[model samples]
Target: MKLYVLSAGAGLLVGIIYSLLNVRSPAPPLVALIGLLGILIGEQVIPVGKQWLSGTAFSTACAKAQAVNHVCGQLPGRQQAGQQAQSAEEKQS
Candidate 1:
């Protein structure tokens, strides 16, 4: 997001300078507005930026978390471990 915003700002500054160089002779409002919008959108859509996160970020995160929980939660309890023959003998003594 920061990169996108910065690029847009630089584009706007350049646009302003270029417009001034033309003496602002009957400057078109729509042209400036549309140009700025185009620059902003281009900044976001282009791979030159890391602003937009991957679409799979959230989905992959969710799957990893669920897998971790499933593995942890299904693990044998200490009580079950202690019921093994060696552990049971130790406990009985």
Candidate 2:
């Protein structure tokens, strides 16, 4: 939720900058795609940074950040698969 709010705020700032510069609201498709990609990667920075600061292994930090999931989003049936995995783990425990 906080991440969403921050994302909206960043977008609002960019929109204001664009308006002041007389740039169009929606940039060209290539430019927009690049920007969206940057946003996706940027969102992982803080989580990774925090883990790094705490001395976690780089691979572990990346796993905790779930960067791929954040960028590509959940696939079809991913939630159910994850739940089943969790249940299996609990059964083992």
Candidate 3:
């Protein structure tokens, strides 16, 4: 029982260190840089993508996708204008 416990503890320690030292999510710096750039580009691209997106999601476009893009682009401006108008009306009353 004591021997088994010691072996288990040793195995656990070795596994932990092996995972720490040999584990890698290694990416080439160029590849990582390109991936990061892709994300930034995609942020801009995804909105444009929605306009032409079809309802079919797999190969083409999606309706929800377009709606999300449309709302995200328009909502803030609409809200700000509404708020300003409301404040002006409140002051007049």
Best by TM-score: 2
The estimated TM-scores of all candidates read 0.27, 0.61, 0.27
lDDT per residue for candidate 1 within 58-89, as digits (tens), equals: 43543433433333344334446756877779
Q: What are the root-mean-square deviations of the candidates from the true structure over C-alphas?
A: 18.9, 5.6, 14.8
Clashing pairs in 3: 53-61, 54-61
On a 0 to 1 TM-score scale, where does candidate 3 land against the true structure? 0.27
lDDT of each structure? 0.55, 0.83, 0.58
Global CA lDDT computed for model 3? 0.58
List the candidate 3 regions with Cα displacement exceeding 4 Å.
1-24, 50-93
What's the true lDDT of residue 64 in model 2? 83
For model 2 the local lDDT of residue 79 reads: 79
Pick the lDDT winner.
2
Off by over 4 Å in 2: 1-8, 19-23, 75-93
